[model samples]
Target chain A: TLLENPEGLKMGGERRKITILTSDLRGFTALSERLPPEEVVKILNFYLGYMADTITAYQGTIDEFMGDGILVLFGAPTVREDDPRRAIACAIAMQQAMTPVNEKMEEWGLPLLEMGIGINTGEVVVGNIGSEKRTKYGIVGSQVNLTYRIEGYTIGGQILVSETTLQAAGDEIKINGQKEVSPKGVKKPITIYDIGGIGGEYNLFLETNEEEFVVLPEPLP
Target chain B: TLLENPEGLKMGGERRKITILTSDLRGFTALSERLPPEEVVKILNFYLGYMADTITAYQGTIDEFMGDGILVLFGAPTVREDDPRRAIACAIAMQQAMTPVNEKMEEWGLPLLEMGIGINTGEVVVGNIGSEKRTKYGIVGSQVNLTYRIEGYTIGGQILVSETTLQAAGDEIKINGQKEVSPKGVKKPITIYDIGGIGGEYNLFLETNEEEFVVLPEPLP
Candidate 1:
């Protein structure tokens, strides 16, 4: 996209609504502790590489890869009414993509990796940002914090979305459950929904069963 | 260094004693919420760029920059007897460097950034790791987990080191406070010390005053 339209990027910023997606690998530290670093990196690469492909296909701009966590933004460079719907659809695809990733892990005699994705839709400032020496296309706002808080509540193989995301996604969004809770530093209690699937044009769902996180055995002496 | 000593690189893994230094910017989320993303990046770049110079000067290899956190390795590619001492000295220098970084922040009408460093010395596997498509020189061991646990104990402008680091750095390392706490999943309770300074050929100290971290105000509507 940068190749096609270098001039499309605005220098400063304006308030816009964007959907944020954060996915983190469950038991990554366990994998690192028990396996060789080579094995750990290979497993991480397989999972990350596949998710990267899926994220791009969904028109979500990959923001940052923080260790085993992938942060993605949709409707940042350009805002569209369909962004909320697409973000949920993209998340469903990423979850399904994990099947092949875990297959490789199983082949390598490693524990299956489960991913948890958190999504939120809200207004934030997104644009080109930094000093003259270094610049980055980024987003910043209180929404970013809320999204992380929402992500923290998710179990492996689960997709959780904020109340704002539920509203933005409208009636087409399918939900399995909803919980009302107050996150630290938030002004009011908000409802976060466990997403089952989204219907209409993009019909997708996961045949997922979340299990209690099994802690890996402590490293051998 | 890689150009001069390409043959020094080893392919596989071996147990080697290395000093791991992890530094994270305190209140980074607060800064991002209040200021523009550009300002946040500017502040981050200033701190990271300066630390990169000091880390390189001290022969510490930067492993990765995760958001506002910088992960570094000493005695990884090559094991050195003085790695522990150099790591402490480097921590002191990095803390001192924060004064100038804060000055720039004050100049820009932004809040000062405090940094907490965690240092640990232990045996970890260090070598090139990954699949054929992508490779990374990395380390994996329980020590990595222990170091993060120690870092959790530090306040802003403070340096904390595990007991192994205290033993490795020997008698020249001066400390301010020590606490015995059992981190989760650890078999034995270990003492983590707050570092004040280090003495020897590389005499370096930070005139740092550790303070309770003041939480940033909630973002305006």
Candidate 2:
């Protein structure tokens, strides 16, 4: 009965534009197996609950929560001119907010948690998808898929942004050009960068479709 | 094991003031009874999913989803100077957004859903609450209780704001004030108002608190 409704997949003719952000906990599966299920759930709720609040603070919509992972949608359901910037800004805020939250967890004798985030922005179908009875508002496109793949490559506690995101953000943030490497599925290596300075001289690189490489001030421990 | 947590009940400690909004679907039981159980669940997911998005868009935390009802918390997990105002604005947005959503439902040949929203603001303890094994973050206090009680008094498609909420909104909205009426377990008649303008001088007077009256313009027969 739910699938009978055509509205189930219709996008209301709204443009398919959105930002996809994928975040996952580092070593979550291993930790969950080692810890009691109840404790694991409690800790996850406490932390994800916090992350969800921060993302929402900037008009981001949580697309879904999959156990140890979360998908956030920005610039969908509502459009904002600063959606890309807001998505990246939210990534930074999430990183900063986790510090105090981890401290509280440590004080409670719980293991500190780490996260990896990947953000991508592009035009994609945005609307209801499901049976006539149950419909989920979501974004679907290659960008969404690439975001998850990008998240898979992150080494935890780091945020990876796609070239499209960089283009949208323009000069608001500084980047340390990273090496170009081929990501899985994609035919060619995509250029990737590490954000270095906040504001100063043009540490900019030529816009080219090259393999991706990362330049961190210090190697990730 | 998810049941026991040392956190216990998070009674007022986090923020000095916060806003609580409780929304319940009218005639949900009867509506569900008319449909297949699986279809019922699907319909509910679609409606509630949209509501959740709107709430989160304004930085509100969805505490729980009970059947056709939802309890939302604002100003906890994330603190802002104007959480009360945010709650009020969110409620209004929910009401306005529902029109188009319901129209989409009609287009899909699904029954239109109606809900009542209640908003209140005051100091409350906000944190993790439960046994040692499992804990959930939520707000607790008399203000929280009053917020729920106010929800009970709301009718379909109507938003009821407490005197506390009114104080926060100032002259930004026009509300039709009603006499203070005592609710169950509470001794005082809490001053409440119909959120949007009903019509004429005021929306219909309940005459008796238990009676419901529609305030919208006359509909074509």
Candidate 3:
């Protein structure tokens, strides 16, 4: 039944500052090409499964999943002062959740997986979009693109966050390193920070002293 | 509040024969680059909104929407003998739906939109994926890849159906033209049919004598 006056959807959009999160498995695409499709999907299910719960726990709204990649929004349907912090916490938690996922994969004779998460905080047009009859929470901005670019820079098991997110997330986030890159479509060089952990109330950290994953990826355009 | 025994959750995947549909807008990506991202999303909402409702009305399970593209399943979580027929009818309905969507775009002073739909049928692994805590129905197979390849052959305003889908849908489907292309990764060249309409119970047809849209797209890989 279609409602003539769909109460939830308005034609226009609202501009608001929000945190964007994009995560993808490193080397998984090539790995998927080698394995059977079912096996590939099985690995993805386990990885995306744990990540979904972790993101929901931190109040992040999952926007969509493109194959093995996931895009999450921190403040679209609703806003929170700690949206950026929560996103950071969620990324850290997601990284930690990988241990159990990998363990399970090992038991099943599947390859261990590693994920890279990127976060950016910026103003975007956000709203209940996708026509009047459906409630598809949609957001769009250059920040969304930048988040994907930043994720592209990450190696396996790494979290690369934009400086804007760093500003919003505050000083609790522990940065191990930083890099400047001029991502495609961006005019100027921007700095992105590699984060190891966050402190204060939601204290969390990426596993330390782990062998570094150095697989460089072709940056996403 | 995680349920250890999620009633509908099954760890294993099920193999099933199903129909797959993928559709996308042509040249929209290049056109969108010139507009603001918010405007891009606004245009997408109207386009995807109608498509969503149309697909739902036909009992198609929307797998996901990647930007302006949508992947739908006709027989997953459940199946029917006439799934291929339903997919054909749904594709015809989706192509015809572009009329109203474009009209709204014109009223809003936005550029008109055109869509191409493709359908294919084959066996695949389908199941309630993600995790026991969440019911994310997922599918993966060579058929899924082949369906994408078939959709990649479509031009805007065209409906392309795979030979497999044609055979499954029976003779009620109307084929306007056919082409044999060896899409990348496929071992042998497969024939795809350009459909004009479907006969029988759910009668649907594309408008006759419409100006041919001549823009050729670089096939999706």
Model 3 spans with C-alpha error above 4 angstroms: A1-12, A25-49, A64-69, A107-110, A130-134, A140-155, A160-205, A208-221, B1-12, B25-49, B65-69, B131-133, B141-155, B160-221
lDDT by residue for model 2 (A17-99), tens:
67888898877655654565456556666666678777877788886665556788888788888788777777777776677
Per-residue lDDT over B1-221 for candidate 3, one digit per residue giving the tens place of the 0 to 100 score: 22222322335566678999999887675566567656776677767778888998999988876656788999887788889999999998999989988877787787888787888998777765564444567776667768877888888889898888999897678888999999866789889999989988988988767546666899999
Question: In angstroms, how far off is B139's CA in candidate 1?
Answer: 5.5
Candidate 1: residue A159 Cα off by (Å)? 1.1
Best by DockQ: 3
Ranking by DockQ: 3, 1, 2
Off by over 4 Å in 2: A2-15, A196-221, B1-221
**Between candidates 2 and 3, which one is better according to TM-score?**
3
Weakest 10 consecutive residues of candidate 3 chain A by summed lDDT: A1-10
* C-alpha lDDT score of every prediction, in listed order: 0.76, 0.66, 0.80
Clashing pairs in 3: none
Q: Which residue pairs does candidate 1 place in steric collision? A: none
Find the candidate with the highest lDDT and give its number: 3
The alpha-carbon deviation from the true structure for residue A196 of candidate 2, after best TM-score superposition, in angstroms, is 4.6
Model 1 RMSD to the real structure?
10.6
What tens digits encode model 1's per-residue C-alpha lDDT throughout A1-221?
Answer: 32223223335555578999998876676556677655555555566677877887889887766556778998978777888878999999999998887776777677888898999998776765532333456666678778887888888889999988888886778788999989976889999999988888888887745534566899999
- Per residue, candidate 1 scores C-alpha lDDT tens digits across B57-171 of 8999887665567778999887788898889999999998898778777877888898999999987766664323334666766787688778777888899998888888966
Query: Who is ahead in TM-score, 1 or 2?
Result: 1
lDDT of 1 at A210: 55
